[model samples]
Target: RKFWALARTGQGTTLRGNDQVNGYLLLATSCDGTLATTATPTTVRVVCNNTLTIALDGTTRAIKVPHNTRFDPQAVKKQLGIAVSQWDTFMHRMRTLSERKVQWHEAMGFFMSVVCDVPPNSKLPEVLPNERALRKVQSLYEGGGRGATLESAQGTAWGLLNAVTEYVDHERRARSTEYRMDSAWFGQGAFIKQRALQAALQLAA
Candidate 1:
């Protein structure tokens, strides 16, 4: 497949399905397996694709860098340190999710209630979209896939949230990988994750 070059840096290239750049895949050095955000010269991480979407990787994952920012690879890499305060909050949420266990059926139901099976929520605005969303979400919670493995998804809110994030970033149908990345970070998928996060927080409470 062909991709349009969206951004070029001393690190690597960010490619898009088109010039629109709602999102693009990033190819960069691993920075020893750490990932964080940057702001000087105006860098912003809109989406991180694939496993990188969830964490940082050495090679390609989707993202959006600000147009005005200078793509200095070293500068970008220098910014790769965990945000301590943010991670504390994130880990707390994850802990809550892990501790609050539910049965398989309940996990499935919670996921269904969160995924957008209807408009203004569904990533697919038309074309049997609601059904598509329902099926996609169902498969992630119960399908015999890595994200759906019972150990990962059947008993805890953390697992369920992980499954949803993994599915949205990698498995859900989209116009392109770039579109999927955009949705995962900025569009419907992002909203769904927020809902899932909120629901998870509630469960913890």
Candidate 2:
């Protein structure tokens, strides 16, 4: 029997396909010692446990990795959370430091430019207190130090906020096309949490 599934629902190993059919195919392939993700009578891509082999017609293509691949949702989520948290902390630090100066708003504008994806014209000229993290924004003309160069503050906040905008755009694109809506939702949920953290940081600043 030729079995191919794109949706492994119950199986926790893969979010791309359902597990029931996968279980049957797995058993059959294991017994036959021939498992394939592609269903081509002339070309079959097979994986036997950790080992992978591709057979084209009667000819063997190559022998590669031999290990069962497993995907853990918990692990993936944890990693994503950690990554976002790091970015959030870095942004918060930059914001906090910028707020200390008399021209804090100007510095904020520069900071936003570095991190955000906002339109050039719409970016803030002043370091508008974001929720409280005073972000130091540097302009293109500004030197390496913590202050904003000659660039105005209006666009700086826009730049910082642009990061959030970029994130939202990425989420929208990812959700628009995949069958993994749950994962998509999870991604957006993380974004929301990160934004909230940034907002909280601003409030505390």
Candidate 3:
């Protein structure tokens, strides 16, 4: 049996996600309303899922492809000629984070602040997961492998940013590989990375 893979690029659509996840950005042209794909690149998760298939080439923007287009295998291979390296992306981001410095206490405090900010009047269901998120961050801070390192650049903004990414990409529990991929790109994990990125960038100022 032979399987065919297709590549499409264009404006992507986003679906709302639960508290644990953020949302899905549908990216494929010929999706059967339930097929999807996601790549674990820095700053974004390329994805396909939940009732649609569309493709987009973007870091922070989605450009949609038409649904009726078709291409042969050679075309697919040529377009996506080589695989993107996650480590390369990480090192690039590390350069930025390394520029910004933070103390160990500040790093821990940052995660502490990431726990959901509850309104004065909140729904019961929302609180637990948010609390769990806080605990998860705390766990990572206390002893999440290299996440606990406090040395040179490792203990500052660079370390904290890595802590969040490592937790999202390697630590956080997921239902399956697909689920983890989706969450890493479109769910809470992505949001956390973005937040950390923003925080890290702020330090550079």
Candidate 4:
């Protein structure tokens, strides 16, 4: 099932250029028990069709019901209603991130920290960044990313966070579009994004 709804207030933010950003509430479920009934707050970049979940206080702010349990539409609605009320707070945080300028070195470090891997039995000094992914994300964060040049994004933590989201949603390798979408929303891609959000928030802080 697919549907779209606009926010009642604080509809969106217009960037310095033609790009605009809008918030959405995404609901999904599966009958075969492959997926959970979840309501996630999301944001879309109109220019490139990139998406990011609205995370607050390092949480995805998603409400989920396992398929094994009975579905409760009203209860889900109540939780969603509370989530919706956080739109203003979320946007305020985004604005703060946008204003928090980042140097190129800081941005590089941020990406390294996000995508690094430490082999089992390896020491902290052996932690290594995923070179290919690092290069791609760095390029995006440095201006190749969608909306990268927008005033709100250029050299800012908000922009850095969006860079990671854009990569996961549109550029990451996948066997098929469907697989990519599934991962972006509910699998490993989701975890990567959450990590990026937390890192970005730390950078801004």
Q: Evaluated with TM-score, which candidate comes out highest?
A: 4
Query: Can you give the TM-score per candidate against the true fold?
Result: 0.52, 0.20, 0.51, 0.85
Which digits, one per residue and each the tens of the lDDT, describe model 1 over residues 14-122? Answer: 2221101122223322243233222211111223222212221111123333435567776445443222113334444455566677776566456656674332333
Which parts of model 1 are misplaced by more than 4 Å?
A: 1-83, 117-129, 150-152
Candidates' C-alpha lDDT: 0.47, 0.28, 0.45, 0.78
User: Alpha-carbon error at 32 in model 1, in Å?
Assistant: 32
Model 4 pairs whose backbones collide: none
lDDT leader: 4
Candidate 4: Cα lDDT at 194: 84
Query: Which candidate order results from sorting by lDDT in descending order?
Result: 4, 1, 3, 2
Candidate 2 lDDT over residue span 1-205, tens digit each: 2223232112112111121001111111122325432211111111111111112222322212112545455754554344323323343343442233324544343334324423234746454433222222132213322222312212233223322322332332343534223222224533432442343234335
Worst 10 residues of 1 by lDDT: 12-21
Candidate 2 local Cα displacement, residue 191, angstroms: 18
Candidate 2's C-alpha lDDT? Answer: 0.28
Give me the displacement of residue 104 in model 2, in angstroms.
Answer: 16
Candidate 4, residues 14-56, lDDT tens digits: the string is 6544557787877777767776767788887787777778888
